[model samples]
Target: MELSKIIPVSKPVCRSSYPDNPHSLCRRFDPPLLVCFSCKGQHLENRRYYYYCATCDLEFHRGCHLFPPEIKHPFHLLHPLTLIFLDPDFQSSRIPIDWPDSSSESDDYDSYEENPGSYEGHIVKCNYCRKYLQPEEFGMAYYHCSTCNFSLHRICAYIRPPLAIENLKCHDHTLTLFPRRVPLPCDACGFSLDTPFFDHVYSCLLCNYMVHRTCIYLPRVIKITRHPHCLSYTSSIVPSCELACGVCRKTVDVNYGSYSCTKGCRYALHSKCATNKKVWDGKDLEGVPEEEEEILEPFLWIDEETIQHFSHDHHHLKLRQDGGSHENKFCEACTLPMTVSDRFYSCIKCEFVLHETCASLPRRKHHPVHKHPLTLFHPSSSNPHKVERKYYRDGFFTCDGCTRNCCGFIYRCSEQDCEFQLDVRCASLPDPSIHDCHPPDHPLFFNFTSGSVMTHHLHFFIQPHHFQLLLHHLHLLPHHLHLL
Candidate 1:
């Protein structure tokens, strides 16, 4: 047994059983009607013994009473784990510890710190289970390593396997546990094994296959919403030039493991990127058959030049290709002024109009910035946000990708509770594409920036006279707006 993984707070508090409560004092009860204060379970029994507090009228499972106050876990050898309490919403309890600023000395461990709260209003997840820990309702206790900012579920700390294993699904040969920590890359995920919380390493003697314990059971076949074809895990890809990961737009090292399209296609993705929680839905499609998807048209045709758009079903729109001057007219979808030579659709009854390209945009699209499908939301005229009359007459929505205020039809994330939205311009940007104004050899990429400034690279390509106009249009200052 690994003694470092389990360290008790103090010697187990031995107390006498309450003779007044016969059922509570017993080791087992049918159906377990009594509630345990620690686990909050209707059943009052577990592998650990039960203890009762006659003074407080509280009963607890023995495991809760003996929970270790500190322990050295193999996953995080840098620091010892401390027992911490969190509410249902994952908010740290009123209890205080050395945090954000750890150098300050405190007279008492349980006393509130003089400094403001260190960690609160932050989402904490168990590193092993990847699930939110809620100790408030269930009376569960979790382990935390503040120095390393690592967390582990209380039960996960007890999950210890034998030194060796055999009969694996992903590999054919028997695998042995490597005892010592090695600074090498895992052959399964192509990520360095020296990473934190990945100390458990397994290896095969028949071949040079070595992998971190966490990556030993990678799915053989998986499907993601971003790709059309199913992807299969491969030990390595054939050496290639200029190969980039489909999701991150970064170069893929061909010598390590990765996921590649089973169908004859050039598409590939890094194992780490493909299995990201934001990208993969955590479904293994090894034996599952692919389902056919039905294509839906964005609009219905009324005549040769007229159609009814889903967004504006109140009236039919007539297409116009002739160069006509509609001085103040703007496309409702893109919020850009209608050019004299542009082909667009105009409402037969009202002033609603859309650029030809914007009118044909799909109702749902896959964008490189987001993993989930985004649904198109028509502009709300009642909204107060708006651009200048030159760009749009009224109404605007903030683009989540570029953080720009835009007056146009926006695509919002389809996932519930996710408020991510972006304008048509930011949504249509290609990941790796060439710009006519910039050098052709250096392809431009869509980089999301949090700072309110554009990068210096723009000054080299943009004309002097138009630079001010570009800043003015984006509502950015001289030092603001970083774009790629």
Candidate 2:
């Protein structure tokens, strides 16, 4: 057998050196022919045999039959796994070994073989339960299992991708996916993403801010403190002279982001302090709880049973209609004036009365706008009363639960180390509610309360009613209600 007769002599030669000529009588050898293992059909002639199954007569080309060495799965985003072909002798009989529906002989094979570059194939695995996927289930990534509902795309199963979160501007970094398992902070919103993340992780280099990749893009404007106005972001620092946030009574400073009025009328908040969702617990105040119900002796027209209040502490507290007073009476809780009210909480001792709406505020709260819980605070905890120089001060404190500023009546933690606070209105809101004025069975609760009156109607009316009903349903006394 002449080797030159069968082999093409003018083919582009490879760099490797080979024998120029072979003996003419070399046992009449012929190149091995490659065939498909399942059908035993001739796939390629004259190629090195790769995949050979003795029990089921088959063969494959070396290049055509190779598997990937390492693969990164979306389901397991933390680490990349190596692909290993299962051996026949392995004990796991449940594992699928064969390709699906390869019996359809058609002319498409010729086209695919001719244009190998255009041919595409993929491998998949389950996200929840680690199961190797069949080729037929390639496109059904989005549709999850009916029983277990574990479904994902090959890319999603292998490499966890990043999702866009809103509003929450994490510390200095933009949140992104974590490559390897390392204790890193989120880039977009400063949070720890070390816990169980969905599929993606956000990280930062400068600070210890890490969070879920889905938590990066939080909403910009949010409701907080149950105020009529919507709290808008202010890039500038809060005024130092402002003392505490209007919602949570925490110290407003330059370090954290602040929310304030565009008109700059002494209204300001720490970004996290303003969005508290609960009422303050009275552990932070220094004085003992007042027992006696105080009613104005001058306005004492009603009987003793009808009047319920702390009479010894207050001098001139009185009941007034909502938006009834022209003169701005400073609130004992927030040290502000009563603008609108269906009811009012007044101090008979010092002519101080908050709007009825303001009096029924909460002590602590949790907000959607913030990641953590917040407490409320009153004004006079540290600072003296601006109105009465001789009177003792009592006010709310802000909780450091979230990143909003304290704006309205606040709920604060008793712990000196933890200055957590939430706005009174924020704290008093329920998770869900049904209203008489609005549609029946309508799920309502205190959401965030922005300062803007035009857009935030829920804070003005819905929040007040919601708090009142909650107090009534909880079986709290009117005096105890003031503690909210």
Candidate 3:
């Protein structure tokens, strides 16, 4: 038989029941511990109160013991949260919505609540702080709302103020917190809520505009990975303009929002495109002055007609502007036939012929075909980038830069083992270029190349009938423009 109850150390604990320990005793701590059992809060060292202690290791405060079985919180107002100390039901029900076992409650849950105080290798994200909660926080006390499956740190719940967010840049209305996971698209960034199942967002019921709570804090100006300049945020990307993103090459809606260079540069990007983890470095430089870049001239004058070529060794090549039509004349660099009125470089005596631009090709070049720089490779040399493979005896080297299988001069990567080969057309593209007859006041910049035509506003169009060109049934690839 059990002996009589022990003497009252302090006052009697309130009438409350716990899941793990039901009939608990009232006890006063000799030396107040640093933490309480229910709230995991610091117990004042001197002040004494009624506390229920199942074991000497864990104790709860009188107020903590009297926590309403279920209470409503200001952060999430849709559902009342039950005081769940530790529930095996934390593993959300995963049955399909269409199946008989399925329900509205979320089953895909975090593993931290499964085995209390034993989540070793896990990524537990906190919805309130927008940070990954450490393993110790899950081991300690916390609150969980089963309907939304949203959990908060025990300490965070106390200090977190009522939900109230607003930003003039994103929206004018006062935003209310929406804690439930819904299939809704955000209006500020114009993207669907791309977070996990349990995350929350801010909504403006008046305008029907919803935005991720995190996106409200995005910087007005930022430097992305692909560009060196800081791009300023634009609230209205007019839909009729048809702007393309510099990173993903996707079309940006004119009526949506985006970022663009402030110095009248043509570099434009979508909000999501610029803030991507792969593209953005997470720096806000709004209103910071960034220098405008100018495209530099590619070459200096060598002479009037005759010039020394970088690809050839012995004699100077003569520039022929009026070399009329021929039976089978072709440029050695581009491997394309030369038409009448085409300007090109011709050897004095030998069968060497190159387009005038190709003669001035740089010995080394940087092209988008490879991340590393490429050097012009000549025949009869060992290249480090290529594995020992047999080549056609017909003097033909495959050019990956042009995606062509032909014989001609090419640029190749030698050190990085980067398997990139380029013909002169893809290799010698200049940073700044000028026209022979109608050059623009500012040099044209080399941005990127694609099958799509550039959206730049053309200053003027030149007449195509100025030259008496030769015609042939040459069925080659069409639309290889130096895409601005």
TM-scores for all candidates? 0.60, 0.28, 0.41
Which segments of model 3 are wrong by more than 4 Å?
Answer: 1-55, 58-177, 194-200, 203-209, 217-231, 238-255, 260-269, 274-285, 288-292, 306-354, 359-484
Candidate 1, 129-219: lDDT as tens digits: 5566543311346688887788876656655555676746767887777644567788877787666663577888679878877677777
Residue pairs clashing, model 3: 92-107, 93-107, 237-254, 238-254, 239-254, 239-255
- Specify the poorest-scoring 10-residue window by lDDT in model 1: 95-104
* Model 2 Cα lDDT, one tens digit per residue, 106-164: 21222121111111343444553344444333221222333343444333333435543
Which scores higher on TM-score, 1 or 3?
1
RMSD of each: 12.3, 22.5, 15.6
State in Å the error of residue 289, model 2.
43
Which structure among the candidates has the greatest lDDT? 1
Candidate 1: list runs displaced more than 4 Å. Answer: 1-167, 197-199, 224-226, 239-242, 248-250, 379-396, 436-438, 447-484
Report the error of model 2 at residue 281, Å. Answer: 27
Model 3: per-residue Cα lDDT over 379-468, one tens digit each: 533343343334324567665543446555667664454455666554544333344343455333333333111223353322111110
Instruction: Provide the lowest-lDDT 10-residue window in model 2.
Output: 110-119
Itemize residue pairs with steric clashes in candidate 1: 452-481, 453-480, 453-481, 453-482, 454-480, 454-481, 454-482, 455-482
Q: Estimate every model's Cα lDDT from 0 to 1.
A: 0.60, 0.38, 0.52
